[model samples]
Target: MTLVEAQIDRIVGPTHHFGGLGVGNIASQQHQGQTSNPRAAALQGLDKMRTVASLGVPQVILPPQIRPPIDLLHDLGFTGSLTEILPQVANDAPELLSAVMSSSAMWTANAATVTASVDSAHGTPTMTVANLSSSLHRAIEPQQTLCDLQRLFASFATIIAPLPGGAAMRDEGAANHMRLGSDLESPGIHIFVYGDQAPLPHRFWPRQTLAACQAVARQHGLPPENTFFLKQHPETIDAGAFHNDVVAASHHNLFLHHASAYYRADDTLAQIQRRFDDLHADGLRRIEIPESELSRTDAISTYLFNSQIVSSSTDQRPTLLCPMQVAENSCAASIVQRWIDEGLFADAKFLELRQSMSGGGGPACLRLRVPMKTRELSDLKTSCQWSASLDRALRQVIQEDYPESLDRDDLTNWQIAEKCLAAARRIQDLLAPTR
Candidate 1:
């Protein structure tokens, strides 16, 4: 059965997908953004709201660094607040320092030291850099950082199976080399890692991560039939060099591939029309607004221009496009205007947020969703609120005890995560129906 089909079978359970909206900071930094500042924080909050509204899913997971302002969450109708987890770092070690640092240097210097010192004093050092830089570089390089960040965001809503290849195996040129397809199942999560020609050492490393995922599945007593692996196409040597060879190898129910063509002055409107025609023929969906159009100071004009095309098109299938206008101008008003003008997205829901410190992503990039019973939405909101309350309580506790017992080895990384997890579990259990 397809992953979506399997998820449908769950009448009542914790079946969900956890997507990582690509590294939020990467985009934010590229755009000269910061999440900590009040204005940026407010924008982040709006973005989170858009995520919930657009996806129609409540359990959106994000990096610990991405906490939206509480008021923004409330405005977005988020009954539940943000749940902050340690971002998944590239290192194999469970050290909290490595995990946080892998994603953020500032996090490493600030939170890592505190967590590490706490862990050490408690006779457990929970922070260590696993020397997985080589592997991390292979998996996500600087040029393809945006793609990696998107993959990270998607991972939160879907099971992200690490592809084979250690850090050395990543192909610097191929954007698709590091990502593996994810599946949403009822009893547990499963992901398929494919591609044979990843850069190096990391290519084979995905197997180990796969094994880890499988173990997690088994521990949950999920059936083997729920798991699957799609093999790589032989001719697919690099990411950029796409041939029908790789496309033919994709056996999953859905295949997502990226395609782009620049529009130059000489190109006529017919050329753009032909380009989209070719794309539809190839089963590719247009999800992002072209970056060129967004660069203009009149971003709203560009958005209107593009929206006209989308509005006129007869196709109803969802297309992925950055609401560049939304990114450039922090408002959903235009989107609503467009919806009214053409009755194009009238049926479609609209979610808009102010840009976050981690720039470039819209609602779609930050949140991941596993199609679930409509009831779960309420559950998610409750869980989110509980998490917020807990975070507030913890912050209060830390402040009250400030400078009184600031020791490095006081709390292990695992212990800290365990504490957080326990609190979440309690909230979850309270919401869950008792036998």
Candidate 2:
């Protein structure tokens, strides 16, 4: 039973713009009201999937959700055709219009938290669609996201219903979760990082709740002994480390994070090391970037901790797929070189994700990883699989239909809305499951 981790990436939508909807993410706010190139943004995302596939790793595609969710507008007491509603909303309230036009779905890391069959009692992969109860723009995603997940994987995986309770049980999904094991085939230790266990001082409110993390563990049937819940440092969240992924990342046997990732970072690592050693004969590799070396401000700005650590075919250690910003940052570049010298990583691949990066996402944020058995992959639906043909087809659509550039004002244009809707539908059709 060979298990491999597959990168499930979502295609950037036609409405990709910088409305600055995210509350805690500093990058998103900093670039607010700027013009965005939807065509380039969507193409860059596809190119990333192509790059991941070229590395001899399995890659999967998740379709983007349709933008200008008019149903939401109708629910808000707007009555008319999409054209009529667009101008009405623009006149009545521009903020409400911006919320519906958000293209945040491209960052699929917040899509869901998945449990590999190796770690579950049922011996089948399980996914709990994130409720994303923190913000208005994101909160509207779960229903559509759940529908898409079910359509794609219902035959092979157990899709757990989103957690029921509201904001009190706010769930931000896999962005705040980490799993590490000796190998992909073995049972792993689950570390659910939450922002607040007890309310303390902070600049921004935490998105994930302790109750949500515990509920996900229970729903997935993860063994108690192998599961641990850790609290994110209050200061880190205030520093713009909105989710744990902003401060930490994990591969099969390696746990790489910043010193300020948790409230009690040293003790947390000790407990994780103990659990990892107990589960498998191999020990966990811990790499903690200290504040003296890289301040929390630098980590958030460069998105150094948001890189994806993936297994390499040519080397024993994994490769770091990081944003180009890290390579440009002198301090970040030096640390990455040090890691390579120490054999912590095989090498680093700098990806050009400026569009997504400016919107507060990086290489890791653009994906959702699912560890699947070869047998599971073999029997999986083919439409979601990545290949040269699918890549070409998606690129063509972006070139032909997606907007060259968009501003906040364009979000309220009915013609722009129509084009976006059509492009999303075309991509959705292209990735629809084949019988």
Tell me each candidate's TM-score: 0.33, 0.97
* Leading candidate by TM-score: 2
What Cα-based lDDT does every candidate model obtain? 0.26, 0.88
How well is each residue in 308-420 modelled by candidate 2, as lDDT tens digits? 87774456678898899999989899999998998888889999999999999999999998888888877667788998998999899999999999998898889989989
Tell me the spans in candidate 1 whose CA falls farther than 4 Å from its real position.
1-35, 38-43, 50-58, 61-161, 168-344, 347-360, 372-435
Error of 2 at 256 (Å): 0.7
Q: Extract clashing residue pairs from model 2.
A: none
Q: Please report the candidate that would top lDDT against the real structure.
A: 2
lDDT of 2 at 299: 92
Candidate 2 residue spans exceeding 4 A from truth: 199-201, 313-315
RMSD, model 1, all Cα superposed?
16.5
Q: Candidate 2 at 401: error in angstroms?
A: 0.8
lDDT of 1 by residue, 98-153 (tens): 22222221111111000111112222111111111223311222322233223322
